[model samples]
Target: MTMVSDLFNSREIALGVWLMIAIIAVLFGKSTRSGFGGVLKALFVWNLMSWLAGMAVYISAFIYLFYRIGLWTPDLLKDTVFYILFSATVSMFKANKISEDKHFFLEMLKDNLKAGILLEFLIGQYTFDLWVELLIVPAAVLLAGMQAFAANDAKYAAVNKLINSIWFISGGFVIYHVVDSVIQHFHELLSLGVLRQILLVPNLTLVFIPFLYVLSLRMVYEEQFIMLSFKLRDKKLLRFSKRQAILKFNTDLRGLKRWVNRWNLSHPQTREEILVTIDAFKTQQYLEKAPPVVLPQQGWSPYVAKDWLPDEKLKPAFYDPAYEEKWSARSGNLKLDKDWSGNGITYSVTGTRLAADHLELRLAAYESKKLDELHAIFKERVALLYKNATGVEAPLKLTNAISRKKNIHFRQGIYFISLEKSIWGNITEGYDLIFTISTKND
Candidate 1:
């Protein structure tokens, strides 16, 4: 019974529970199985690298400092605190992308907090210089609560925030006291003056707390994004050339910076690292002289339609009005016509022989807002149909890139596409897509 009681309250038990939560969250959370696997792989790599580098730095720094002071005795408290800074710095230099998915991000938060808690407990067993609970508990609660707020996760936000407030207040009361106590003890041991000890010890540990907080919250999560992207690449789902991948990496870096800036705007250490990623991306060679996007209009030509169906006249077609019903009436300034204006445009064969069949489709939107909506609907529907019927790629890139001409057009084997914009003194606007298809069965 005594053993059972002790086992339940142990720090090892706490760490195990925390790890189990992280694993469950990642596996059943907002990601696919493959994505969760990638996230775990990335976290392991990040932690492994950080641990190795931190141990090396800790050993070298410890040996040099002891030798300089002629003190051969090891100071576990100071050593553990100092080592955290080195480990966290290594993580910063090798930054990773953060995910847009909230589940993956939450899993990373729990995993990192668990790691910190385990570290605090392991180090605490050696030295009772500081209260481990005061440091790790508040840090974990604060990170988890802040993440909930950032993600707008309603289920846990209110409860987390309330509990975090108590822990934060309690932790605040002990932070400086604990650091000072640890510093004072070391000062007496080395016979260092008050001023020197104050400068040497508290500054590093004091600075380390905020770093550890942010690191536990974000860095591990960011690395998972890179792994996710690599997994997509491996599956042939995302096809990108080497140059495109670099460009995409730069974009992800910017996105991660934006996410960090939103949650922890005032963290100077994080801000500096974010700035470094931005500068590095902007200086890339491919992006330096990229051409500005253009949408040009090409005049219509009476080209023979492929596999043309023999029809007496071009058929009338109208744009779907249901797509704009939601936002079309939101602003009173814009008004949509109550009827399909099939007579807005007309087309017919011109030559005497009328040797080739020709067809044209035209649509119109009266309200400026509806014009944008119309464009989106037309593009998506047409792309869908094209993909379904022919098993070919949609022409979205070509459509978006064309210059804004009066009759911008393009033709594939048997289909031609174009759009017309309606403007009335710049106050009212409308647009339509003209698509022609052959009905030949042969």
Candidate 2:
């Protein structure tokens, strides 16, 4: 209570409190992966220098403005002192070591002068009662909350516009009252001397208040990010299902990305590494839950007999005449397609004849299974079919498919097989087995 009273009653006390706030803001306002030491350097080294430079720029602007307005006599040293203190407060609050802009201080000065002029010159004159002054704080906070919600959620745009109008109108009334008091008592207020002017407080405190509010808001978001990071690091799967964990991780990652963009921080390699680890973990979990792989039966080939012909040996149940017109329109080739069921699994078969001696066959199986498991199963099927057709062992390995990262290709004599996984929209949907047999060059 005593300190709060001193803050309003003594300019020195108020200035000291503002300085302490600035120091605290500098100490914790950065996104540092280097821990405590990095925060200390930000406060005492890089940010300190930036704040000092910004302060010098703002103070110069304030002094030049005062001189241009004919209010810069020797007796106005008190006003100059207040301006210096005010500039230091603003500079410390706005300083950023990593992403500071060269024009930031100039922009800050322009904005401050514009705000002051709008409040003092354009608003005319008015006054408010003590009760009204007390009500303004809660009213402003409520309106601010509405504005924040409206900004984030598009459904509240009309409400946001209304809130903005209310703020502008209320601001004009407050400004008129403040400017009126200053104008009507200008000479008598000047006579109160430096100490009294300092005690009464300039509009500097108003400027300082907004900075404090913004700093506090930033701190709140930083604390939220820290909490989210900790949640991501926790390894208890029992608390959250794999899907829930993934959703939460994605949401937190998006929040972190927004924070990084807003602060203009460098790309976070640590977070990327964490994301990779999480993806590997999720993949492992998915593989553990997937059904066992089943290879195709021995000597069972998607081809009809050993000859590549669409009309000669293809069963009527596995032939679609509709594909002939479709394929011929696109590539001048005759094609056939049908869904073939064997071993309780359905395979989509497509055969296209490029020439009398050349044929392309594709067999695709769709299943909701882990990507790695599906690849393993299809690789074995392709190898088996290739060896049965050519009487030679297919040179295939899991590494061959996995390391190739998308598709695998193997050729033996006139028979060539290419294996690939199916990607439906954004996800790995299934696997494909493609065989091309050409006797033209044989």
Largest TM-score belongs to which candidate? 2
Flag regions of model 2 displaced more than 4 Å.
1-86, 92-102, 112-131, 175-424, 427-442
In terms of lDDT, the poorest run of 10 residues in model 1 is 326-335
Superposed by TM-score, candidate 1 places the C-alpha of residue 2 at a distance from the truth, in angstroms, of: 20
Cα RMSD, model 1 = 20.5
Clashes by residue pair, model 2: none
For residues 59-158, could you state the per-residue lDDT of candidate 2 as single tens digits? Answer: 5565566557553445555545655666645455553321224455455556555635434332322335434534654577678987987777667889
lDDT of each: 0.40, 0.44
Compared with the true structure, what per-residue lDDT tens digits does model 1 show for residues 290-407?
4223211221122222112122232211111113221010101111233232223223221111122233333444444435444454444445434533347766554563223244
Runs in model 1 deviating more than 4 A are 1-66, 69-73, 76-161, 164-442
Error of 2 at 439 (Å): 40
